[model samples]
Target: MSRRKVGLWYRLAAALTRPPMMMLFRRDWRGRHHIPATGGFMVVVNHNSSLDPVAYGHYQYSTGRVPRFLAKSSLFTNGAVGAMLRRTGQIPVPRGTKDVRDALKAAVSAVNGGEGVVFYPEGTLTRDPDLWPMAGRTGAARVALRTRCPVIPVAQWGAHRVLPPYQKKPRIFPRTTHQVLAGPALDLSSYYGRAVTPALLGEVTDVFMGAITDLLAEIRGEPAPAIRQRTGREHPHGLPSVSGRS
Candidate 1:
């Protein structure tokens, strides 16, 4: 594919991020063709370490698509990091507030206008002791249902080795392997025009989370547990009920 129209800020951010990513991790990306070639779509990815987004973003950028992520509101505070995020089309979500729904509205608009948005369905890094994907909230389902965009489930592993959750020190010497996998756009037309009830959202959320867990299992060459580990702070339509988790 010849160069797709990616923004300068995205290019700059990738440039700034690539060296550190290169020095720290080896990438194993798969099933990228599952991503829509040229249209708006939603990617439901499991979150573990913060570093995984960089790996995931690299995978997206390499495929010639600049991902629009649902970023935490704090990253948008007035500053250079904030400026870079805004210029690159990331959506700032005031995660715990009632107004978090506004971020959903913005995502819907962007998808309808042909942009790929990435959603970390669990809203934060895994609280599962083993880093398995936890129960996800309804935002991913809400966005897909509202915009009727293709929801592609992406599963990733290995970035946590570079920087695990709840820890400040990163292991950079051994060169962690950041594995990412994407699957075909899920067929959710069955739920397209249904009422956006909690039950409906829950069902769709299951599909998204289930697919991610399956992918993570594949990457690790193991079986996902019948019951996903839960952090016990599930948010119906928002971030974690616990403060300072994301």
Candidate 2:
């Protein structure tokens, strides 16, 4: 099927699912209006739970952008859920591989084709007990730099409570509330058409993480976590590895 058709079907599915989901969450979702109506943009949010992508996808669809995601390839394996994901335009990246070049190309192309892509820089669900964002990978930054697309930092809170990581069942009894805050877009013009250095990439990644942390803190009515005092350096996760400039 064509990308347009896939997008249309996904939007319809979201419309049908959102009301019940929203009702289930009884979510007090706010700042959806802050999402850009038109343009190639990236929606960067913290990953807390498995339900997060669905919630964020619904929210982004409601905000007038059909979100295409970079999901783990494992989720796209042969299965009912995988079939559904295939139809919904979720691109899969193999876990723990340094070769997401195709996925990156697809993302950049989607944005250039005037679609929005939603990604989590943290790569995996938050390991933090508090569900605050951990250090982020540079995929989001790379995409933003390459496409020159606006990276809208989304701070999400409470989804973890709805369905905590590794829990087989969600708390569907008493409804839960989720908050999504859309921060201003990152400034990437400085690195436009130029290779992003390690220093530059780190700066951009930190900026995005800081914004998400601030948003989470705001929703939880608590202070953000203190920055690690280590000398700035890149850390490896199980996800694909890429150089700062690549």
Best by TM-score: 1
Model 2, runs deviating above 4 Å: 1-8, 228-246
**Which residue pairs collide, candidate 2?**
97-240
Q: Give the clashing residue pairs of candidate 1, or none.
A: none
lDDT of 2 by residue, 44-103 (tens): 898877887888777787776778899989889869678777888888888667768788
TM-score of each: 0.90, 0.85
* Model 2 worst lDDT window (10 residues): 237-246
Which portions of model 1 miss their true places by more than 4 Å?
1-4, 231-246
